[model samples]
Target: MANNQRIQLKGRVFITFNIKAVTGLHIGGTESGIEIGGVDKTVIRDPLTNRPYIPGSSLKGKMRSLLEKYKGLRQNQRIGQGYIHSCDNPEEYPNCEVCQVFGVPGERDFATPTRLVVRDVMMTDKSAQDLEVSGRTDLPYTEVKTEVSIDRVTSAANPRQMERVPAGTEFGPAELVYSLYDGDGCDVQKDIEHLRTLVEGLQLLEDDYLGGLGSRGSGKVKLENITVALRVGETYAEEKKLLDKFENLGCLVEKLKELQDQIRQHVGK
Candidate 1:
């Protein structure tokens, strides 16, 4: 497929899930210097309410990176070096799974549009009230964590403070939207494959960390109360309301697997 090729929208799948911090999460914000008597590192917050929230970019970027790594699509570069670019020619690399769902950069020739849409995750009001009642008196909805790095040569310690969203905080409702395109000719199964890949990506994200400082135990999160809905045609009446409800993370994974299997069977036929 080429960028000039025509593509038609078949349907869209909407996935909604909640993210709960299993451990303290530190998605770093702009650095406030010690000169201002502010913390060395701060967590991003809502300006109006001053409540810490996870940016959609953070979650989407993390999921894309993890999925790329899982599919061995990562570039041959050292950590903190550079990012891998997606395939430029979809016709040449027709089976490039990551590029299909996540969309290729600078690839106007790619037939399919970007399939995934991730929304910014906000802290639930219930969770915020719980934090206050739990006696977290440091800040309104965040905690300051003190960290230090020791220089082995001189045995000197450099200390800094970081702001983080404390453990057990719940953020929702996070939404992930996946677009399904009508495949060309015998490749009609492409939409199913893409959805399966997206599901797998989310599963991988659940097993991994979301924000910065993962090696030091920050950014561990769990997805909860996942619900799926589908819109099959152009009109609102064509919608399939709440197709499935997943009670827990494990149940969601299982449902995805079942859906994948069914698609595989259909393709085989």
Candidate 2:
């Protein structure tokens, strides 16, 4: 007799914040890696030797970690369970915002919709049957479209800084994304100064370029080219002609200068 495949289970209602910043920071542990030109280079660094390259796996791994941490997700113990799935501990169940939605149940673990993802979930150890896997769990989510920019130091130890997008906005999965700028966001100059103070505490070569801590032994950064352009003109007309191209090149120079300084500081040159 074919019994009905219906079983009572709980559903969770919570938000999962996706990565809006640049991806491909890891030099290992396959996520989505960056291709310098044609070849996919690892962006992580080795702890023993400092060098810069890209690691596809690293990129993906970090993203997974971020999502799991931010969402307070548990590991799926199942074999083919999807990444970012749900955890239902038949043991002492962890209280979660999503779990609360399902009401209190002692027998079954926290069950979620099954998801099929490229990589396995790294954080959880729950069974595969308990996970809700997908390429991205946000596929079914509704994005609250609002543009907000934040200006934060890209790195404290490095001169690199850029305006980042604010949190809480939903955008489709992108390799890299930034928040819109707003006055409420962190002051760019002030943030940079703060980073300067913290710079000394950081060891350049000892850190990975893209991935943060575990990636410390993954890859390194290399300075490629530096081009400086000078503009000369007193009159508005003359200045305008030279200024356009020069101004564009000048920006590149600033970035290069920052990169140069970073290399020198790290390499102790």
Model 2 is weakest, by summed lDDT over 10 consecutive residues, at 9-18
After superposition, the stretches of candidate 1 with alpha carbons farther than 4 Å from their true spots are: 1-4, 32-35, 74-81, 183-188, 237-240, 260-269
TM-scores for every predicted model: 0.87, 0.20
Expressed as tens digits, the lDDT of each residue in 88-171 for candidate 2 is 553333334223222232334343222111221121122111222422322111111222334576533422211111122212
Q: Which residue window of length 10 is worst by lDDT in model 1?
A: 260-269
TM-score, candidate 1, is 0.87
Pairs with steric clashes in candidate 1 = 3-109
Tens-digit per-residue lDDT, 1-269, candidate 1: 45345566656678888899998988877764546756787888888878889898898888878888887874643446677646655463467777777766543545457778889899999998998798864777888888899999999999888778999999999998876666442143676667877877778877889888888888889999888877654543654656678977789767776665543443342
What number of clashing residue pairs does each candidate have, in the order they appear? 1, 54
> What lDDT is obtained when candidate 2 is compared to the true structure?
0.27
